[model samples]
Target: MTVALMWEARAVAGRGEELLAWVRAQDLAVRPLRRETFRAPQDRVLVITWWDAPYDADLPELPDPDGELVTRTVHRWRFEPVAEG
Candidate 1:
């Protein structure tokens, strides 16, 4: 089953653009089938990656940017599609 990984982070104060650049420059160890990134109010950044592996598979996740760039710890979630059968 394909799995989707979601990663999110909020930048400190007025460092939203900096945080976004850092996230854009990151290189994943394992390339996903599909990947996308977005930004929202409150200096937040979100990234979603779809992989062709099991939900519990060990996949290389984007490392956290420098602490100074973020306000708090990064958040992550994993999900798999429900089978119709």
Candidate 2:
């Protein structure tokens, strides 16, 4: 079954791109549905993606959110495709 994993992460000062870059380098992360949206100031971003498999990948370590507001949240959602409106 297809599943969608919503991942939100906040980056340190100017490290948003760095984090995205690292994930993009991963071979399994080439899924086209893995959309990434970066908030202005390049310090915060939210990634909501659909995957054929579960989100069981190794996540890179970044500065703690509590320390630098590097917030992160992960939620697993069962997803299905419907007729496009």
Q: State which candidate has the highest lDDT.
A: 1
Local accuracy by lDDT, each model: 0.93, 0.50
Tens digits of per-residue lDDT for model 1 on 1-85?
A: 8999999999998888989899999999878999999999999999999999987999989998888889999999999999799
Q: How accurate is candidate 2 locally (lDDT)?
A: 0.50
Model 1 ranges off by over 4 Å: 83-85
* Residue 78 lDDT, candidate 2, scale 0-100: 41
How does residue 74 of candidate 2 score in lDDT? 30
Q: TM-score, each model?
A: 0.93, 0.42
- Give the alpha carbon lDDT tens digit for every residue of 55-85 in model 2: 4543322222343445454323344556689
